[model samples]
Target: MRWFSSPLRDCASPRDPSVSRSRVFIYLGLAVTLLLLSYQLILDRGPGIGTSWTAIQGIIVAGDEDRFVPDYVQPAEKELVLAAMQASNMSWVEEHLSDWQVNIYRADAKHDDVGLTVPVNKGNEAMVYLTYIIDRYWSLPEVSVFLHGGRYQWHVDNPLYDSVISISHLNLDFVQEAGYVNLRCAWSVGCPRELEPARYLRERPDDKGHPTAVEYPDRFMELFPRAEVPEVVGTPCCSQFALSKTKIHEQSLEHYVRLQQWLMDTELDAGISGRILEYSWHMIFGKPAQYCLDQRECYCRTYGYCNMTDSDIQNQWVWRGLQLPEGWPEQSESAE
Candidate 1:
């Protein structure tokens, strides 16, 4: 019976050197195969992961220098107002008027409390005057509103134009007629109770050169879909990030060119540069939009436009749209 015992028992024993050596070799081969597979996976995924990481790093590094104080107004309040404005139907002024003029007379031109008086001619040949006093102390970026005398006779529904009047009616000339139309508003300070906390936090100025927000570009790139990313750094449109007003400073055109170069060099989105350039122009050079109706020519070499009027320069280039040259970078789907 011993002689007839199966050879399987002998083969399975730990003392069987051949069987033990074979099992060890098999395990080593599998471990080596897994290592190779993992290495390949990392190599294939490197660029995308690296780009996202870099983008996030850039944002974080940048934020360290430029902290963003959240807007004082509640996000809900802003959203509600914006939503109402968007949903409310308003007619666009299309007809050209012979005597189209917009003027902002300092309400207390006599006193220091400056207010704005704006009159617009509705299509029915009737004019509506809107008056509002601007209070600077309410917020660093003050909000303007309507005074007692503001009304629209021609149309029951007149879009509030404190923000728009300055830009839309730049061509209108100011008339100093007495008793024609009058609207007066008193000045007030302090944020609404609901918004006070947010306002207080925002009003505290950040230390210069410290980043208020941090964005990791690399993380963003990783999170972004692969189809949206470009393979090369300088492909048409690739980079997407926010720009700070301080970053541009006085070098408006140069700032734009640098942004464009960065987009191209980094193979981000080419269109983003143009968009950022437009925004910067608006922030730095655009007269309050309410003052300048026909802003198309405002960017003319002779007539740069800006928030405030300056006699020294004929034209201000604030908020000028980009005029890309021919052979602008071609669009690529790989970098959506």
Candidate 2:
């Protein structure tokens, strides 16, 4: 039997197993101690080491001026309008917004009891909205809330899909501050990067089959003369939004006149023309070309629903018997 042993190990005095075990224990103890110290430092930083922890981020703890309710909002200065077809039922506006100064504009060339009717049914709610701005430019309210005629619609940013609930909780002060606010806060259909005009030709076609979307780049240039068309145009959809009077004044009266003229004169289909304007409204009112708001901030700022997590928003999106992407009704009773 040949036994092989290292001369170095034999020469070296037998190493104490207890000493080796103690060294190992010492190394592990140092590691655990360092880890615990690092964990304590992180804990001192708060709930999330780097991210926003709403609990730690104080709210309205400052003076009254720092509050959400600003003194600039006057109830009488707010103007609410509903864009309606001649046959659409507008009883809900009266029912829900009885306190508001509600105005209705008929799109079917038929005069309502209030004698507000668009000259033509050219662009869905776009025509009505532009008409109101042009007709009342000089006598505009401090804040105008433009809405579709229906009380309940999928586009309305509320759990109930109820316009009444949405409007009832609307933060007018936010509108006054923001200058332009889309009533629909949810960014499902339209959001972050909806249209890239420069890449229109090669981009995937719109599921809704909007022909004018292809022509949007040219139309954008035409709508804003001498101005470069933006690479991307986006906002929350469906034509319902709020504009501060000062915001509307940012554009010349003739600018709106030209937009209306284009709507009437353009050979594009009414729906297509309206859709183009729908995407353009944010830019028209001084928002950036890509105007998608953070959903959490939007809910908090626009409607006073604050401190919501991603999970909270998902829970709120309980669609009432409506299928997604295809189940959306092509035409709601008073849809834009």
Candidate 3:
């Protein structure tokens, strides 16, 4: 009747101490490796996340004592987002937009250290512009103005084609009211009927083998699958524009991400992909295919060039500030 040790108890011995310790060490190693990878991913995303967080907290990231803000003008809740190439001149932004937050996304891989950098420089300004919207969608300023990196470009709507002048005189009130404003008000380049989708889809040998037009139809469908391809697509040339946060939020972040994904996946060269976006931007921002605003009204509303007549717009007097003709209508308070 002595106590008997069961065979089951004898077989069920504790695991070897070394084996148990080895598993613990293995788990520790895996956890450290995962953490390192996560950190590297955050680094790859660059300063966009950090900047967005700080911006959400109401902090202005860049300001210079040397930059002058006129005493009469109060600080504004606006941001200027630029898409810069390697050789683009950004000095004008520092010199002119002292009161606004400026975010420059460098498209060139060579200039890695300059400004904010896009993940890949595929679709020209389209890549940078879409990236800014997707990144800062959660923490956008009251109004975000997107522009090319150069201070002076032919695409700009200002009389001198100077971004500095256009942005400096930009009517934020109009932007607030309009929701989406094409920075270029002129219709000389792209407007009324810039691209005929049916015509562009036809391949032609004379295009020097560049098949951008031939490729645009498929690309357009990729971007807006649910919508029909319009016969004509038009908007002011280049991608410089502004959007109030309210307008930006009208389309969900997923909408922008899908557009960015199309940019990444498209095989069209940077120039052509960018050109397609150059026309599609207005539609993306809820404007009609023929997004040609009245030239006089656009200048008066978007840039405070009030009372500009068709002749003045034709002569580019909006930017020149020539003497107003007698009995010109008073400047609308809304324009101011």
Better of 1 and 3 by TM-score: 3
**Which candidate, 2 or 3, would have the higher TM-score against the true structure?**
2
- Which structure is stronger by TM-score: 1 or 2? 2
Clashing pairs in 2: none
Per residue, candidate 1 scores C-alpha lDDT tens digits across 110-161 of 3223322112111011011111111111121111111112121111111221
Candidate number with the higher lDDT (1 or 2): 2
TM-score of each: 0.19, 0.70, 0.68
lDDT score for residue 48 of model 2: 49
For model 2, the local distance difference test gives 0.77
Among all candidates shown, the one with the greatest lDDT? 2
| Candidate order by decreasing lDDT | 2, 3, 1
Q: Write one digit per residue (lDDT tens) for candidate 2, span 1-336.
A: 749877887778688789999999999999999999999998897764554433423333113232121112223687887888878988878877888887788888454345577756898899889878766666678889999887767677776677888888889999989999998777777787778887774564563575766878778887877767777777888788988988999998778878887887888888788889999898888888988898899999998989998888876555544322332345443453
How high is the CA lDDT of each candidate model? 0.24, 0.77, 0.75
Worst 10 residues of 2 by lDDT: 64-73
* Predicted model with the maximum TM-score: 2
**Residue lDDT tens for model 3, 183-239:** 887787677777777666554234556456566677888888888888887777778
TM-score of 2: 0.70
